[model samples]
Target chain A: MKRYFQNKSLLNLVFTFLGGVLLLFIIAPLAGMYLNTSFNSVHNAVGSEEVQASVWLSLWTSMAGTILFSFFAIPLAYLLARKNFPFKSLVNGIVDIPIIIPHSAAGIAVLGIITRDSFLGRAGELFGIKFVGNPAGIILAMAFVSIPFLINAARDGFAAVPERLEKIALTLDASPTRVFFTISLPLAWRSILSGFILMWARGMSEFGAVIIIAYNPKTAPVLIFERFTSYGLKYSVPVAVVFVTVCLIIFVTLRLIKKKN
Target chain B: MLVVDNISLKAGNFELKNINFRVDKGDYFVILGISGVGKSLLLESIAGLTKISSGEIILRGRKISDEKIQRRNISIVYQDADLFPHLTVFENIAYPLHSRKEKNIKEKVLTAAEQTGIADKLERIPETLSGGEYQRVALARSLASGNDIFLLDEPLSSLDSKSKNELRVLLRKLNRNGITIIHVTHDYEEAVSLANKIGIMEKGEIVHVASPEEIFKHPKSEFVAQFIGIKNFLRGELKALRESDLKEFSIDGIKIFSLTDAGDGEAFLLIQPDEISISNSVESGSARNHFKGKITDIARAKIGIEVTVDIGCELISLISIDAMNSLELKIGKEVWINFKASSCKIYN
Candidate 1:
């Protein structure tokens, strides 16, 4: 018992010492940025209409991407998790490609599909929808890079649901649609919600892809980049601090809601 | 009545070959087999949850092979209950009613819940319920559907003895209410107790289908005999008695008479342990076969003490604990084993 306690204490001490370094490494920079910036500067940055519009546009585009992509991603996640087909492993591997590849490459790939002269681009023209330099383009880029998170998480969620429940539901006279809606979807809702929040956060913080796709719409990250490049670090720090604080508040609130459920 | 007529299905690599059975209306039919014998797969195919590769399922004289599960009007309850975790007990029971858009959902749900003895658990979630209660909710849910046939896949396994007994009673009551049941399990005791007729499956094929007593007394094949755990599977030869129609069986020079109609030739003899009686001395028991053998072993069985006697061949007899003490049965004690001619089964 003495040896066991000694070993456990030593292991815990080493883990705590190592973990604190990484924790401090993350916190110190953010804390430094916040401490160096005066309250007046942050308040002024919040007051600016351009900053307000940029933050609002960022939230709007990310939320749009998260919701719209989820419709396609969720069912596909279910398929990925449940069905066995030819090249199933190949298809599963492809879902994570966006997460593995660089964001700029994903942006360019997405552009290839939506740009003028492409088949989808001309098809969109028939519907009077523009993709380039538009909020639509921003959503496309954001969703493209961040969709893997939703797909992976939702797949795990759907996989965790017992197939026997669905089978039993079907025998109880529930149609396939009713089973999907009432049984599979509700059981997988939590992981889907967590994935939703992660996708939104990742999409909003995206810069490289959004820059290549829709630089003019000026999402909060794009505005921060512009401020830094144009007026140096002094002008960008306050906006960065304020934007991060907003993201944290919203993310924490969403997490708490999920926990309650 | 439901008839699974020559259904052949290949689920992955495991194939059920030309499965055929008839479940009469209001009959409690049980398919007994070890795990992975495609019992659940067969049940799934009958419910239309699994599409048979080639075959027809006829129900009430109408072919339902091409019908979807929702239109089949069959309900199944699994071993672990599989209750919807997000839904309250009431909603879980009401699910089927909601699905088919029935107008009298609340009344049906309440009645079904009350019938399954889970009326007070209507407001609780599935996660909070005990294993027995969870199963009761699943039963209540299926009952609310008002289906003519219900499939139970090992509903009594993984339950405490008390819970198992309660579920068995509930299952008997369900069958009594005019619902045709096709239950699947590996437990022969459960099969014999609850099933009016039992089908024995091995390697995805129904080897035999008969009443529990018939299946136990006269197994059709060596596999069936062994699978049912028949202790005495002795090979013997039968010859006609000179004066009577009864046959005399000879096993290694030991003669035992039986009333089986199987022809006078090589045959297998099955003497159920419980059919054989034990006594300290010879008595006018009127048994056709009596052997004075030394007690080889005594083991505790679920029903009673299993006293193994070695005459020429070893034969086991199940006797009550009271009988065991009265007779002073112990290893190496001399005992007389007596079984009537009708009790011995002969299979060619």
Candidate 2:
């Protein structure tokens, strides 16, 4: 018993030592930013209209982009999970291209189709909207860079659902569409939701793509970069601290909801 | 009634060749084969879950080969009891009714649950149920669909013996209620007990289809004879034919009589192990065939002892352990082996 306890403690110590390094590496900078910032500076940053607009824009546009893209992405994910066809592997590789490339390259790729002379841009002009310097451009860039996370996660989720369950549902007089909605979708909802959360978070933090596409209506990351470049670390620290705290709260709340479900 | 007319399919590299069979209304038809013989694939093709390469499947005289699965009113139960884990037992059973927008669903679900003897497990999820209860839920779900035909893909394979017997009783009860069942199994005992008609499949082809009694009594092929536990097969040629379907055959120059009247030609003779009886004395009542043989070997069987005797040719005979002890049977001891002429089957 003594030897067993000694060995367990030694093993625990080894794991704890390695895990503590990664924990401290992540926590120390965030804690230091929050603790070192004064209340007055934080109040000033929070009260600023520009900062508030940028933060709100970041939150809602990412949420909008995530919700909008899920309609197409979830169905594609389901097809990837269940079907076999020619060029399936090619399509799967194309879905992951955005995740592998740099965000600036991804932004440039989106700009090609949505430029003023392009068909999509001309189509948008019919609705009195332009993509080059608009919120639509920012939304497009965010979705392009963040969609692969949702697709990959949701595909894995759908794959984990047993094929027999769907077959049984079909045998039970359920149409193909009905079987998908009633059996496959509900069972795979948890993973899809997680993917949604991941895409939303990644979209909010997008800097390289949003900056290249639409810099006028600044997102939180662009605003932080602007402040840091113009007024150095002292002025930018409060905005960064406030943004991190709010995102942390939102992420924790969403996780708690997921756990309850 | 269902008719699978020359239905053929290719799944991966395995091909199901021109399979033809018909299930009468309210018949317990079992397709008996070993695993990997495309039995499940055949069931899936009939249910429209998988596509057949050619030919048509007719149901109630309608060509349903092109019909969607939802339009084909056939329910299926798998061996693993693939119940929805996210739904309660009652909910799973009622899923078909809800999907069809049928009224009085709650009562129908409850009646099905009661029929499968799982009324008490209505609120439980599948993970919490035992194997038998899980299978009962699957059975209840299929039963509640109100389909006239039920495709059972070895529904009793995964259950314990006690549960298997209970499910067998339930299956018979369901059959008596006028449900046409197409059951697939590899167990000969299950095929013999539950099936009125049995089709033997080998290598993705239906080798023979016959009544269970005929399959056991007179297997038409060497594969069927060996598969159904007929241990003794002998090569012979018919010498003469007598009245009342009696025929004489020679095996290794020894004459034997059989009840099947075949033409004078080479034939295969099959004798079931249990049909041959052993006695210490030569006296017999009505056994037409008898031989003085020596006990060559003895081994323990499930219900009795299996004694091997060399009556000019090797023959296996099953006798009760009580009989074994009384006869004091031992190796190299001379004994009498007797069986009726009707017990020997001939296939050419």
Please tell me how candidate 1 rates in CAPRI terms: medium
Chain A of candidate 1 compared with the true chain A, TM-score: 0.98
Give lDDT tens digits, candidate 1, residues A10-124: 9999999999999999999999999999999999999999899889888999999999999999999999988998999898899989889888888888889999999988988
Provide i-RMS per model in Å: 1.1, 1.1
lDDT of 1 by residue, B141-176 (tens): 888888878898898898998888787778888889
Q: What tens digits encode model 2's per-residue C-alpha lDDT throughout B1-348?
A: 799999899998677999999999999999998889999999999888899999999999999998888788898889984899899999999999998899999899999999999999999999999888888898899888889799999988888989987888889889999989999999876776678899999999998998775776678888887677756767668766644457887888678888875457876677877999999988668778888999999999767899999988888999999999999999999999998889987654
Candidate 1 backbone collisions, by pair? none
Q: Which ten residues in a row have the lowest lDDT in candidate 1 chain B?
A: B227-236
List runs of model 2 lying over 4 Å from the truth.
Answer: A1-20, B230-316, B319-348
Per-model chain A TM: 0.98, 0.96
- Model 1, position B127: C-alpha lDDT score: 89
True contacts kept of 1: 0.93
The estimated TM-scores of all candidates read 0.79, 0.80
